[model samples]
Target: MPKIDVNKVAEILKKNELEPTLLRRVMDELRLAVQPDPGEEEKPPPIKKQFVILVSDPEQKLPKDDFVGWVLQIPEEDNVGTTPERVCRAAYDFNDTKKGSLLPVSTIGETLENVPAKHFKEYNTWVKTRTPVLVVRTDNQIPKEVVETEHF
Candidate 1:
């Protein structure tokens, strides 16, 4: 088989009036096409799970600057019911041990609600209608304020 000369091909393309930008783009595409497929061993990073807890203050007891929401990082394999129970227990223990006024885990459990899976707009709407919401989500789904603000 005759060896194809890259310089000769470029010269022919130039002589035929092909634009330099178009040639470059075509070359880039061909180069991409020739790349080896990613190996199975080179797996993508695992998605981290998070819990978004939106606590509402119906009695307006908390300070104005305090956030009502919290984003808690959890293990990717944690049980759905267990993590929230653990959170509630921690909140209860903190209140009981430190002489705080936070609600009991049983009470919080009663108010536990699920956010809609329809994403931001639906979540916003659901939040507007409820108090003390709990939802399991991936890291990407957490709201910016929940992670940045003081929600304790």
Candidate 2:
């Protein structure tokens, strides 16, 4: 595991406009959560797993032939942003990348309701654009060709 840098944590919190006083409380709670008590047995891994999917707008009528791969969120710069020189940075934080990234997303999980209140609008917009539910999987999991056959 990597060491947690307190200064980096503080910097991130400050950049997000969070109060410094909350840092100590969070660190204490996190420390206890990660430490195991004496004689406590290790828990087994989860039997079920959840996944995340990226949805794009179908209204744009993008070509699907060349679209293949995993999707990653792209961050952009704007004025009034988290880093003051930029603007409304958080506004575009959750915005999906262009539909032409040539990648697919695949994973299913319950709608994430724990998103911060500040990102509600952007999150909702994504929810509304359920064009292609791209699936993200390993190279072996992806078939070399999507075959089509005719039946008599």
Candidate 3:
């Protein structure tokens, strides 16, 4: 097969004004398509695990009748130790609720850090009855289809 000039392809994509995210997706697909299939003896790729990080005011210390919780999806591959801090920083940056603001990372560390991460399937079963206030993908590991799914 002829070699593909990736740089030229990228230049063409850029000239067409393709969005960066779309360009990334296209490149990923191209890479996948070009990869050789593994032999039967070779092990399959590892299955990526999804975790749910729930940030909420469980004690109702905030002065609000209905405080909404933040639910974020992170890949298990992320640094478990620093995930809480990342979540806190994201919450601080993107919070739009009328409920009380998120406590500083230091103050909320005990609450967020201690909360156990739940597998996506397990969390999905548990959260069936409840509606999420805000749900976001904190990592790029999750596929676009999963992120865009109605249930997600």
For every candidate in turn, the CA RMSD to the true structure comes to 19.3, 19.0, 19.2
TM-scores for the candidates: 0.22, 0.20, 0.23
Q: Which 10-residue span in candidate 3 carries the lowest summed lDDT?
A: 120-129
What TM-score does prediction 1 earn? Answer: 0.22
- lDDT score for residue 140 of model 1: 37
Using lDDT as the yardstick, the better of models 2 and 3 is 3
Task: List clashing residue pairs in candidate 3.
Answer: none
What ranges in model 2 sit over 4 Å off? 1-11, 41-152
lDDT ranking, high to low = 3, 1, 2
Q: Write the per-residue lDDT of candidate 3 for residues 28-99, one digit (tens) a residue.
A: 887787677776377799997543433344454544443444344455665556544554544444333333
Give the whole-model CA lDDT for all candidates, comma-separated: 0.48, 0.41, 0.49
lDDT (tens digit, per residue) of candidate 1 on 48-118: 75445544555655555533443433455655456455545444444554333443334443323332223
Error of 1 at 23 (Å): 64
lDDT, model 1, position 93: 49
lDDT of 2 by residue, 31-143 (tens): 67667797898899979733445345445455544443322232443322223211132223423434312332222111122222344344322222223334433323445
- Per-prediction count of colliding residue pairs? 0, 16, 0
